[model samples]
Target: MSEDAEKIIERLAQDLRAGQFTPGSWLKQVDLQKRYGVGRAPVRKALEALAGRRLIRHEKNRGYSVHPADTEEADQVLDIRVAIETGFAEAICRNAVEADIVELGGLAAEFEKIAINGPFHLLYDANLAFHGALLGCARNPAMVALVADLRMRTSPAPASQWLDRSRIERSAQEHYDMVEAVRTSDAAGLARLIRDHILQRAD
Candidate 1:
């Protein structure tokens, strides 16, 4: 893909991640073009790229649409996440600095603050920011990108994951615990926490 196309793909993917488009909703080329302020070619290329990534679905005459939530698929993706993220704990703890811990703590606090009454999107964004920062501590961009793509595949809409305010609050506390685990360089503890956090949702 061309540089322009790559940029468009990232932009469009971010929107998809943010739930800008509902799952199973059709993506019109004209709407995408207006949204990204790009020409037809780049939008088309971006859609094709995303489709290849399994971020969206493509049909013969229907063009592209978001993948609707699938329980089995989501569970499988969550299994992959637990493996990757928990395995990454040691590296993350080794590479994390005070600054990284502080950043994570701040993000965790932000999420906790909004867990009870904030708008769903903001709460979701806060949760994403916290995890993105946590993953960055590992200093593995490739792994981080893969995890992000997997997350989008499993949970196309953030609202679907929130479920209830109590669950959201539990997730918020887990974020703080994750930061603390990093701070203490408790790799094993972090791994357990990561596994529990990912698997608890499926319970």
Candidate 2:
């Protein structure tokens, strides 16, 4: 993407993540161009990027609309996440060093800290960072990329999950459990923890 188009895409994606646009509402390119103060080219490019991620749908005449929630689709993505993350955890437990566990603990702590006093976006970003850090420990670039793809269309950003502190705490505890399992090089335990952690309160 050109810098102009990338900037527009990022702003559009941020709006999508923040739930500024209602799901299933058609977004006209002309309106977007006006709203973002951009030209037609960048607006078109931005919409295309979002559509590719399935964050928005591009119908022939409809232009673009936010992707509506679908329970079955979400569940399918979550199941794929479980498979990827479980394998990621297994690899991490087998290959991780002490430094890797320490890093994971720190990332988890930062996320829990933000959860307590969150501008929900910060909390969400921290959650993403923490999970990404854990996946990094696996050292398989392919698995990391694959898990990221699984997350693209099924983000919980539109959900009210983060509004519940108890769920956040539970997720944080799961991160700690994963760290412990990795420290002990318990591959089976780590895989189980990863699966549970990814699925908990994730609707």
Candidate 3:
């Protein structure tokens, strides 16, 4: 909750998503304190915050560990997201404003730029902002939060394997297509794009 803890939370969350820390690895407070150059209280709070988001686990005696990537679970999460977000995209298309497209376009540009040369954390944050803006056009806040949570469950490690490559350029183009789909009110096209965006793998 403190400023220092908030900073630690962002840093740790970025590393966790970037796969910098191996899945299921123990996260000792002392080690994290040294790594982040913060105190015990901030480290503890950061770990607890991550645990709350299901990014890590807290054990009675063992402090915390990175949440193991569960492939089946990740598949299920992405599956559900495809369903919810496709529907949300259709809803947005039904009554979208020009401003929504403008906002999403800006975020997409930011993401493309960051994904190219920025640190993984910055790219990850930019990606989140792009999706957040896309989700923002929807009617329900609960749906937005649900998509964000499911995304956190997927994290960056699995996706980052390909997303960190030249494939990111392809991904950036998809973002542009998404903007076009929305601008044209192509609901079915938007839905298909959403499904592919979540399910596609880079070859």
Candidate 4:
């Protein structure tokens, strides 16, 4: 993506995170043109990109609408992720090197800092990096690709409703535990930690 396109995507993602757009509401190109102060091309590109990720739906003549945040579907996605990632942790246990652990530790520290800070966009990026590093440790190209795609498709809901110091702290603790589990080559422990972490809110 060009720099301009990247900026548009980031802006749109931030708007989504800030609840500037509601689920199932149509996003007219002309409206976006006025809101974003951009021409049709960039707005069109952003909408198409989001639609491709299933974050938005594009109809033949209806333009684009924000995809509904279906909690049930989110739960199912979490379930599949837990199963695959748990198995991935086992693989990491068998193959991870010292460097991998060190990198993971650094990512965890970053997450902690974000937890202490108020801006969630940084936290979101760090969280993605931390997990992407774990998936990398699995050393399976296909799995890495699949997980990356899933990560984009499963972008977490806006943290606006869920953002609190206590929640951030708890999330940081989860990251710490995950890093320790990976460092100790505790595959089963890592698997359980991930599963519980993902499902915590579902409870």
Candidate 5:
């Protein structure tokens, strides 16, 4: 794909992730073209790429549309996420440096600020940044990429999971605790924290 097509994919993916497009809503090529101010070719390629990612569904006679929320499938994918993300705990602890810890702390702080009053999409973006930085401490690019894709596969509107204010607040605190775990080289503690965060089993 061309660079423009790739950029379009990311932009459309962001919109999907942010819940701007309702689940099961058709993504028309002309509408996408108008929204992104791009050509039909790029929109078509972007929609195809998103469909391949399972972020959207493709029909034989129809074009692409957002996948409807599936609780069972989302739960199954969340299990996979818990396994892979928690598995990264030891590597993340071993490889994380003081600078990385500080960066994570900053990201956590940013998330907390956003969680208090920011829009859902911004809060989601902050959450992603925190987790992305935390995972990057593992220094495993493949794991990071795979986990990211799995996250998108969990639900068509992942940001909808943050709709509860109390849950969002707890998540903000969890981010800080995760940073502390990395700072202290607490792999076991980090693993447990990650598992709880992913499963939302933390109190």
Candidate 6:
């Protein structure tokens, strides 16, 4: 993909994260073209990319619209995330080096700092980085690809539901626990921690 297309995708993803695009609202190419000051090609490419990730839907007559959020779908996504993260944590526990643990610790510290800050966007990126770091520790290309797809699918959730500082703090603590479990080579503990951590966020 060209740099412009990549930028368009990132901007659209950010808007989706910020709830700028409401569920079921039609996204006209012309409107997006005007909003982003981009040409038709990049806008269409962005929409197609998001649609491929199931973050948006393209209808025969409606052009494109944000995907409707469903509780059942959210539950399923959470379940998948738990399974992937548990395996990731276990892999890290079994094979992670000192440098891997150090990197994970750094990501955890970043997450804590973001939780201390009021702006949720920082928290969001930190959360992504924490998980991305875990996936990096796994060092499995297939697992990383699957986790990336799942992460994109779950990224458009309403920020209002995740605005509680206490909840964010709890998540940060869970990241710490996960890293400790990996450092100690506690595979079972890492798995349990990941399962509980994901389900807690689903609540």
Off by over 4 Å in 2: 1-3, 117-121, 156-159
Candidate 2 collision pairs: none
Which sequence of candidate numbers ranks them by TM-score, best first?
5, 1, 2, 6, 3, 4
Clashing pairs in 6: none
Model 6 CA lDDT for position 26: 89
lDDT, candidate 4, 1-203, per-residue tens: 23476688678866764456776689999998778888889999988987786656799887998656655665676677777878788998777899998998898888888778746667766777787887788899888766654544344354532456787788778888887888888898988887886666411
Model 4 spans > 4 angstroms off: 1-20, 33-42, 117-121, 140-163, 201-203
Query: Global CA lDDT of candidate 4, please?
Result: 0.73
Full candidate order by lDDT, most accurate first: 1, 5, 3, 6, 2, 4
Candidate 5 — worst ten consecutive residues by lDDT sum? 154-163
Query: Each prediction's Cα lDDT score?
Result: 0.87, 0.77, 0.78, 0.73, 0.84, 0.77
- Model 6 alpha-carbon drift over 4 Å, by segment: 1-3, 117-120, 155-158, 161-163
Best by lDDT: 1
Better of 4 and 5 by lDDT: 5
Question: What TM-scores do the predictions have?
Answer: 0.87, 0.85, 0.77, 0.74, 0.88, 0.85
Give the winner by lDDT: 2 or 3: 3
* Residues 48-117 of candidate 1: C-alpha lDDT, one tens digit per residue: 9999888888998879998886768778989999999999999999999999999999999999888876
For model 6, give the RMSD to the true fold.
2.7
Better of 1 and 3 by TM-score: 1
Candidate 3 displacement at residue 29 in angstroms: 1.5
The candidate 2 region of ten consecutive residues with least summed lDDT is 154-163
- Which residue pairs collide in model 5, if any? none
Expressed as tens digits, the lDDT of each residue in 43-153 for candidate 5 is 999999988877788998788988677657778889998999899899999999999999999999998888787865677667788999899999999999888877776
Per-residue lDDT value at 189 in model 1: 95
Error of 2 at 143 (Å): 3.5
- Looking at model 6, which ten-residue stretch has the lowest summed lDDT? 152-161
